[model samples]
Target: MDGATGFAVSALVNILLSLAGIALSWWVLQNVRLDLFLREPKGIQAKVLYILLSIIFGHGLASFLNDYMSWSQMLGSLFG
Candidate 1:
């Protein structure tokens, strides 16, 4: 697919993945005993860090997979 098509697909997939991640995180927080965010301070710094890290790890994984698959597809098109 072309770049635009790939971008559109990725955008849609990312939106869906984000919703799924939020739901999963909420479920885990409600049901699991991990207490992932309990230790975070109520200060603004902690809130900012939590938000940044969450975004990085959450969307970063999807972005990495998207880029990797694009490269793999490129290589396949070139060699196969």
Candidate 2:
């Protein structure tokens, strides 16, 4: 494949991998509910917390997988 094609494939794969992380994070959040015991406006803070948790969980899991499996290099190779 050409360099541009390789980079495009690598970028697409990376995006999908992160999305898998988000999906997994969503599944876990659905299974585990967190109650902050706050009223309406204050409750928005709780929602924010949930959003942050999902982002953290998603990125954290993705980063861990790449590091553990040494797939980061493979992905880098695609770009190179």
Using lDDT as the measure, which candidate wins?
2
What are the lDDT scores of the predictions, listed in order? 0.64, 0.75
Cα lDDT of model 1 by residue, 1-80, tens digit: 99999889978987877666554444443444433555746667765655565565656555666678779989999988
Model 2 clash count equals 0
Indicate which candidate wins on TM-score.
2
lDDT string, candidate 2, 1-80, tens digits: 99999889867866777789977887787656476344653477877866777888998888787576567677888999
In model 2, where is the ten-residue run with the lowest total lDDT?
33-42
Pairs clashing in candidate 2? none
TM-score of 2: 0.65
Per-residue lDDT for 34 in model 1? 34
Error of 1 at 63 (Å): 2.7
User: What TM-score, to 2 decimals, does candidate 1 have?
Assistant: 0.48
